[model samples]
Target chain A: MTEPTLQSDLNSFDLKAFLTEYGRLVVAAMEKRIARYPEESRVTQAMRHSLFAGGKRLRPILCMTSAEAVGGNKDHVMDVAAALEFIHTYSLIHDDLPALDDDDYRRGTPTCHKAFDEATAILAGDGLLTSAFEILSHAADDGLLPAEKVLTIIAGISHAAGCNGMILGQMLDIEGEHESLTREELEDIHNNKTGAMIEVSVFSGAYLGGGTPEQIAALDVYAKNVGLAFQVIDDILNVIGDPKVMGKAVGTDAELGKSTYPALMGLDGAQDFAERLINKALQAIVSFDNKCDPLRSIATYILTRSR
Target chain B: MTEPTLQSDLNSFDLKAFLTEYGRLVVAAMEKRIARYPEESRVTQAMRHSLFAGGKRLRPILCMTSAEAVGGNKDHVMDVAAALEFIHTYSLIHDDLPALDDDDYRRGTPTCHKAFDEATAILAGDGLLTSAFEILSHAADDGLLPAEKVLTIIAGISHAAGCNGMILGQMLDIEGEHESLTREELEDIHNNKTGAMIEVSVFSGAYLGGGTPEQIAALDVYAKNVGLAFQVIDDILNVIGDPKVMGKAVGTDAELGKSTYPALMGLDGAQDFAERLINKALQAIVSFDNKCDPLRSIATYILTRSR
Candidate 1:
């Protein structure tokens, strides 16, 4: 399929409209998957409460856009996109646990533990994590991709989200609490904790979309820069973004003594880094034509997003 | 490969020797897999602590034995077996959390939370859960099974282990604490919490082993009965077995006001029920020849085990 006419008309780009149309699709897929369980059950209720809670649905959107950029079908990637959201949501739930970030609210509402109990929240997180794999396996069964490719995707995702990836980042985050970290150490933490999953999200989409080796390599480069920029922006937001706009309180990273980009680099320096990274991200995808505009816009949006 | 002579030599069968030989293989594989991570890392250390704590490698053994019973090679099923143990170990780590059963020790050693911090313990559990999928994906990559079959196995296991299965069971168990539960309610909890995963373990093994539909169905029935009996025997052991022998405390269920077979039924009645269940388990596989002796022996061993 050729690039959509609307995508080529970049001057008329509307991030809100784009997200609304695509985000609804992602949310619908997520809801359909979650609805398969008994709705009245507490665990189900807990899962739905957090899942349907407000978020921008960025990861799933990124995944779908990455797939489309590679000339892959959106229908074929929807399950995987939803799976990414599930994993993302599960991580948020766990991060809100009393033992972790201990946040009372997320996205301006009661966190899972605050909505239910700690035990229920933990189970809900676990249920979501396992459910993500379940959904991907079904995607393979549904012939979204060859089973071998799906298996490869699953393995890649597990590694990215597992100990040496997101979990490692989380471990480093917890350990770094109250301790000062060098810029390098902080980069290592964010790369593992937040960047790994984001990179995998994009890589998974490109792979499932049947991108060529060169295309996948370019997207990987693009995703890494985007991921780093995304986290840096997050750090900047925590320092200055309004709580209401951001959907949660700001400055908690500093309050908790987290090793954030703004803490390691000065605020202006962190902002400069995010801008440079986004430029690099756009440059990595320069070989692709208008078909990849969504990715390009997303890199720009990551730096400019209020939340 | 036909049944090994030792498996057919029922008169001279020694469960200890059999478990020793096979258990070593399962444990060694598990150790090798765990060793892939950074050795000195805290999360890895926490994961290894519970993983190598010397539980009877029953689930993995069941997986391998089921595969063998169906004429599939052990090497083909080893990764799945190890994945099962990873899931089992992760569940134990979570179950031992302060918000859950609050056990200080498992297998006569400090629980993960007690040994490591609670956050590390939680991350360890998460790491193991993700790693299980990672290993299975590798199994697919290694050509252990057709990718389609591997995807099917992953879906089945997730359904059995996720909200509707193990997590559901766990949620029910937590909610039922300090409350009176009818026999049916308790059964539902155990069936989901314990039986679901066990059933999946056997089903995965049988499916991956290329079992015929009839063979898989029979194993499912056998697994259901064996799983329930296994839990029942666990209750009996808690009430009567020595702590040193069991390698954990006894009577905690009763103390927590949790329902058990011995609670609803008298001691003799519970024991009788376990015997009946084992017989039913054995009967399910009776259609097969002496090649199925290990399964039959496992059923008997479940009833007779001290731990």
Candidate 2:
């Protein structure tokens, strides 16, 4: 994970440089906004702890890239880009609590509840959840997009993160823990749990970026394919990824008795499935211009990334 | 608590019918929206369970009442009024968790986590929190208000529910639990924890009701005074009010060893303080016409309410 090597078929666009540049902007936006709150608050500290816990800012990067791909300035969607990260971080903080997954560490550091206490972690998640909306709605104040469009984006993102989306997915995940799940059940869980937010991130950025109906439709297809591919790869990595390369513990998913792509299918079958998903995803965005090269590169990165 | 009594001087308006009519609208909105989700989802059931768990729909009632008081149709702020109730319910679900308040019951029924499991309750809270924003943002699609105003309302409400408002208040509540708190400290906690959302509920309704600056200003003053008075009344009820009338336990605050107005000041002192605050609240709205009588009656309602 130290250096992202282009180990897959496509390498025309340098994914590393793309991530570094846009990811920095996303982090800067989040840091600047979070800095406005009081430093002495324990919940703020807990939020900061999980937020900066060394993970790739892939969701926001995908969003910013999608915005640019559709002929919009990345700056226009920067607040929302940061908001995606906040939502992800909040989910992680809550997921790691003792009543849920109960993980002590995330990304090689203490989880929010482990770093602080359970009550603080819970409130920190609540704060970040609220803060994400604050960022989303305030995007209208700067005239970043039309107020109508801002409301549209909020509706879409909130839907993805809400009842039938990520929350439902999380509920399904815990429900399937004790029993062996069929391939369909596992995919259903991951599709709702992980794929929903990822797909909406791409769709939201494009819609807010003023993409045409056709272009947004196509990107939605691409997003759905790629989002699932990303999770398949994550499951693959958890089973076989090197700890040094992944920068986190390996085989933890297996240890947790969780259903995963590799667990459902053999390693080779899982990898092949991931490859097919990437191919389908790339096909969906074939008509977009070279501005979408980052999107193309991300598809490759999903497969080639060792982490 | 069973029948509204005009114990104080300002019972010119029918407060019971006001609550019944507006509260039913708020509940209907919530029920219709929630019905669209999958019935089999445990999270959905958990959300429904706590949401329907019969408490006074006071917050949303206040918002709708404020909108009416400011010369706007109550229907205009109905969605946001429902959103307020969702936020309040979400906070209650999370607050009652074992990691937080650990309460087994609310409104004479099992708490969310007690009715379902902890994980389901947590996700249910997450669902309702996100759904609140979904409702807030989508109000624009119905032409309920201008998109800009919708965005403004979303920003304001999210801020109140987020960092320096309710979330901060909850964090401070736990932080102050083990120690004797000054009156200022206790007020700060109640102001943030309970007062922030309550005050914003008033301000948001007034703003969305198309109140003029002068009108909104006066209502803000009224809201702040009544918000604090409401908390003081709650504290007094926990001390001496009948559980049969309250339909909830008495002395739970004292059991928690939590900070309270009655803890800092004697019961008589707290009662007198609430009276002064209610009077100030009444005086702030004195310039308004009879349309604001509901606002005035609510001030009296806070004092005379046995619950």
Pick the TM-score winner.
2
lDDT digits (tens) for residues B12-111 of candidate 1: 6776688888889999889988877777778999999999999989888888888888988878888889999999999999999998889998999999
Clashing pairs in 2: none
What is candidate 2's lDDT per residue for A1-307, written digit by digit as tens?
A: 3455653344566677777787788889899878856779998888888777768888898888888999988888888988899999999999988899888877878889988988898899998999999989889777658998888889888989988799989999998886789999998888899899998899888988889999999999999889889999899888878877665677878777888889888888999999999999999999889899889888878887877
Count of clashing pairs, candidate 1? 0
Off-target runs (Cα >4 Å) in candidate 2 are: A1-4, A7-12, A244-248, B1-8
Q: For model 1, how does the per-residue alpha-carbon lDDT over A30-137 read when each residue is reduced to its tens digit?
A: 999998766877888899999999798888888888888999887898888999999999999989899988898899899999999988988898989999999988
Which runs in model 1 stand beyond 4 Å of their true positions? A1-9, B1-10
Residue A15 miss distance in model 2 (angstroms): 1.4
TM-score of chain A of each: 0.95, 0.95
User: Whole-model Cα lDDT per candidate?
Assistant: 0.87, 0.86
Best by DockQ: 2
lDDT of 2 by residue, B1-307 (tens): 3444754464456777776777788889789778856789889999999888877788888788788888888888877888899999999999999999898878888899999998888889999999999888888777769999988889889988988889999999898886899988888988898888888898888988888999899998888889899999899888888887776678988888887888888888998999999899999999999888888887888887887
